[model samples]
Target: MADDETRVDAAEEKPAAPSDSDLFRQSEIAADYVEGLLDILDYDGDIDELVSAGRPVVEVVGGRLQALVGQRGATLEALQELTRLAVFRQTGTPSRLLLDVGGYRANRRKELAAVAKNAVEKVKEHGEAVRLEPMSAFERKCVHDVVNAISGVESESEGVEPSRRIVVRPAD
Candidate 1:
């Protein structure tokens, strides 16, 4: 009986991980808040929330949401932080949140990945460093991951925020 209890305990001891529904709930709450804000501002944008890359992401699409995104997405970044703060206040847990406006983030990430791939090919061909255009931290991270996956090459970021650029070079 003791051995049986031990087996049961071990079986129940799976690694702790949040469920997808829990993550989706966070996105839903964020979307509701964002929708209310849009309504208050008399903005016309469709809000969508979903789980992407294991994190909650909210996307607002419409001409009016452009202001929420701001110049170079500065306003969008600020709004994301504020949304995370609101979520944390309610759930008492910090969130790895992602917010996209007008599909900018999704489109930008795709473009950055392509740029990174091109730089990787250039570095492999010429054995010289390839400097990419300035990108946000999230964009840099995506590039870094893509570059890191390839052998004989590496990527690193230089300069400061809003001006930070990624450089891909040979592994050696």
Candidate 2:
């Protein structure tokens, strides 16, 4: 029937999701961009490009990279945005490329997990909601993951970017 044919045509018109190869390519582009930055800054690092969790990831590992991380990873966040822009310029598509330098993200995630656990414990013991300090999207996600894995507690984010924070409460 014509209806079936029209339905098929509509489905075909939908934009296809980026394949794994496409994500990997984004990582490659981001890696190259980060490498150029390191070169310009006269910094030494080992860059690795890959696709992880359906997103591109560019990790730079090296010594004396504290400046790149900056205070509370502000510089690193800026670099990630710049690297994402570089990928967008080359591929004509926005990128969700995660850029990690000097194992900052990994270390931060561990610290956040501990913080989340503490928040959950406080919420459980007091049977009251506990508000945490404002955190970046990445940090909020890390805390959410830890809180979600533990029972008897729930977490939610409130407010806007650069000021958004998490609130952990006892499960109703």
Best by TM-score: 2
- The numbered model that scores best in lDDT is 2
Least well predicted 10-residue stretch by lDDT in candidate 2:
9-18
Whole-model lDDT, model 2:
0.95
**Per-residue lDDT value at 78 in model 2:** 95
Whole-model lDDT values for every prediction: 0.87, 0.95
Candidates in order, TM-scores: namely: 0.80, 0.91
lDDT of 1 by residue, 3-113 (tens): 999999999896555578878988988898888888888999988899987898888998856788788778888888888887787777788889999987888788878
Please give the RMSD of candidate 2 to the true structure. Answer: 2.5
RMSD of each: 4.7, 2.5
lDDT (Cα, tens digit) per residue for candidate 2, span 10-100: 9889677799999999999999999999999999999999998999999999899999999999999999999999999999999989999
Any idea what lDDT model 1 has? 0.87
lDDT of 2 at 12: 84
> How many clashing pairs does model 2 include?
0
Q: Which stretches of candidate 1 lie over 4 Å from their true place?
A: 1-15, 159-163
